[model samples]
Target: MLASMPGLRPDQEGPSLAEQMTALPVATLVVRPDNSIADANVRAETLLNMARSAIIGSDVARTIRIAEAGARFDIWHSNKAVAAYDIKVHAGRTAEMELDLMIAPIVDHDGWRVVSLHAQSQARKIGHRGSSGGARSAMGAAAILAHEIKNPLSGIRGAAQLLESSHNGQDSALTQLICNEVDRIAALIDRMQDFTTDRTLECQPGNIYPLIDRAAGIAAAGFARNVRITKRYDPSLPSANINDDALVQVMINLLKNAAEALEHVPKPRIRVETAFRHGVSVMVGDGKGSAVLPIEILVIDNGPGVPEHILDHLFNPFITAKRDGQGLGLALVDKLVRDMNGFVQYSRDREAGESCFRILLPMGMA
Candidate 1:
């Protein structure tokens, strides 16, 4: 228990290293001399919304955002362990969390790090890190903006229909385009509303293979027509803890992104694979205990990988690589998965190799 407040004590006995880290409520991370993540405990994974394997080599700065100026400045500079109170820290892509942060240099390993994060108060449990204090203001603006835009859009569509009925010139074509674009904008707002609304998840333990099959089938028939989609599944894998609709939508979003990226590749192939991983668990949702997330779903594509610059913020809202993208696909996927207490991350098996999106979800039972 955290009453003992586990640290990076090498000689600490009894519980295994992984078990000790998993048992502690504190978020602990070890950064190597080169500033990459060498290791991270379960609480850190829970804070960062990634599996320990996926997080192992990611750049430390990109993963954890230090919001304030002085909170971490003196600590990192002095090469000494420093504890600071009530400082804001943002985990990857989610909102910023204010944590009691501790950073210490590992003396034996040439400037390695042992960073720990703890919540100072019961009122400040870490979940829901939205905009940098501007979320409520943004929500109000979105509501008003959605209302104002929809009313005018309805009028424009009605006017365009009238013009299309009466006019037969090329201007009538312009009117049709206007109507179609207006409808498109309306549909986009509906999706945006999905992001803004705080809806409860409809979660359950259900078979995931069928969901993956349906999503992949849709992609192959429609957007992914040029590529071949393959599956490598463990038929005995347990049911996943999730909402079927949300999980299907996540699968479809991932498949569509992969298919779109592979549009021009000659032998563009997409792989959908599932397996059961043992001893993989993460702490999610206020850290009552660790949840065993053994079900693994991987979406591997044989296209040019995701760009390096955007990889760090891949799950953040409005971050996209496409010219005409609003960048909500991966963001929504992240939110939906978190609602189900699942984890998804961008990873590559080897350095500078094929990119893969790995999703680790909890099985029906612990």
Candidate 2:
């Protein structure tokens, strides 16, 4: 075994270390006990501009050099994980590249480590740092804009509604349209405020199946009327600690996005699945340790998938693939999930021709 967890066996249960490394999108290298490069994935081959055959069994120090003095040796000596960001890297004979590195020792193995590298360009594009300065600035600006526009929007809607009763024929239809558009703008403003608000949700132990079904039912009655919806849930899945309203909101947003994406597809289909995923956890608020997240919810869609240009920023505010989208749906979904100590991720299953949004929530403590 390349690595071992306390009670989990990679060989029988989940992915093997080699398989996981190969699946990663970023470049990865495994270092042997003797400081030789044990393995390099295809991404590593491309980044280092060398064949995998040539990279394996080569001296780790000579093949991948970290410009941060003693940074590489420190992890080796301490046997601890190290995360070095925006550091210079020299790969083989290639010119220097700024990259982020995640170096961690292989459990149950001595002097064996796995190194993952993210090029600066890739890192900048896909990195989700919503708490960053730029994101905060954008959110601040939006909050102000939403506040200023909401009052006027409500007035416009009220005026249109009053005028609708007095108008006839084409004029009546126009008044109703004005009211509808104004209400739509008001709704958009409310969603935008979710990004600026810092409200804490009161989470409780509850069955997640009901919430998922409720959201799906709502979608079927409205935007997803023509779309095929399927639900495959693990009945034995444990209760998750989540805010009922927040979970429903998150599901509805995801389902609506999926329905819209499949608007032009020949046979559009969306699947909502739930299961107990083993060995999944994330850092807790205190940052002293992590909380296990075993409950998994997936919203899978067979559509054209998100545009590649905005895939990296799919959850970022104002980054959208839709022509008329305000892009706060996923952003708000991200916030609400995190507030409940859960996490979400999106991936495109190229072979299956599907887009999947996976949400993992912690089991109820009670």
Candidate 3:
């Protein structure tokens, strides 16, 4: 009966699904109906610090017990379709590391399952301060330009309105064009004013999950409706000292970009995760002492990865991949993060074909 099913072969054809799953960047496991391990991926083998031959045929719960002693056992035993929990792994040569585990069932494979695991390392730290002076100067220049243009724009609109009043028929079209161009320039100035304003963040120590949830909700209701959003949160994550409003803006910008990138892909997905990291430090500038950044927020998207051409200048002002984009979203995000003494960087996983953005911030003022 199983052999008769489409895409299901009783005998081996090419590489088994287990073998293909094992080749993925994510750690995977194939379990029998009785929850015995049938196969393990190469990433899983390395993550567990064990050989695949030693792990196969082992009872799934027994393996979990040995590998993740601190894991929540009840969650694993509940037979849930999806679960995420943290565990500590002792790296032989490197320091002990914390890891997040995701377990999900695989359909059409006879009750088998695949588990994806990601290590929680401190993000690559960045200096506390960035090129804020340059940003401020740019904003100043924009503000001046807006002011200079607005005066002439108002005169142009008034002159056009007067000309329309005096026009008999066909010349009204030219007056309308002049009015429309003036309105467009005014709209551009309004957007630029957001940056020109001198606004300071009201920083406080607060839970970041709510901000992430709010942004995710906004995305789902609009641009990201077709995309699946998964959350893997560390319950023990410490509150971060940041401006709640600014953080929300940052998350919204990131979610919007992720949604835009996944528009053409099937099964679009984004993952929001937060955790505490240790041993990561950043230097403010050349010859500056390093300071540790322990709090981390990660936004990961599974879409067509970023283009190679613009990868290097992704954070620069006015850099954008989308047509009709003002290119200020990320620039604003970078400025806001810097104001909160945080840093953001992007990484592309070519093999997995995913783009990941990591934001590192101080836990609290020291």
Q: Pick the candidate with the highest lDDT.
A: 2
Instruction: Give TM-scores for every candidate, taking all chains together and pairing residue i with residue i.
Output: 0.63, 0.66, 0.58
Candidate 3 C-alpha RMSD relative to the actual structure: 12.9
Residue-level lDDT tens digits of model 2 in 1-366: 445555785565655777877888988998988888889998999999999999999987788775544431333344656554345668776888776667788899988998887875433343333134434555697789887998888888888877776664448878888988888888777777766866678999999988999999999999999999999999899899999999999999999999999999999999999998764544332223445678999999999887888777777788887898887788877778878877677888889999988888889978
Segments of candidate 2 deviating more than 4 angstroms: 1-139, 155-177, 284-286
lDDT of 1 by residue, 112-214 (tens): 9887877542212212222222233334555776888878999999988888877755487689799889999998777766666656797778999889989
The CA lDDT at 98 in model 3 is 55
lDDT of 3 by residue, 1-366 (tens): 122335756664556565567579866777776778888889878876778897788776656542443432333443445423234444322346654455666667656776566664322121112346535765886799788998889999998898888775559989999899899989877766667866777788888889989999999998888899999999998888889888999999989988888888888999998888764444343323334567888889998866777665566556688887776777677778877777787887879888888888778653
Best by TM-score: 2
Who is ahead in lDDT, 2 or 3? 2
- What Cα-based lDDT does every candidate model obtain? 0.72, 0.78, 0.71
**Lowest summed-lDDT stretch of 10 residues in model 1?**
122-131
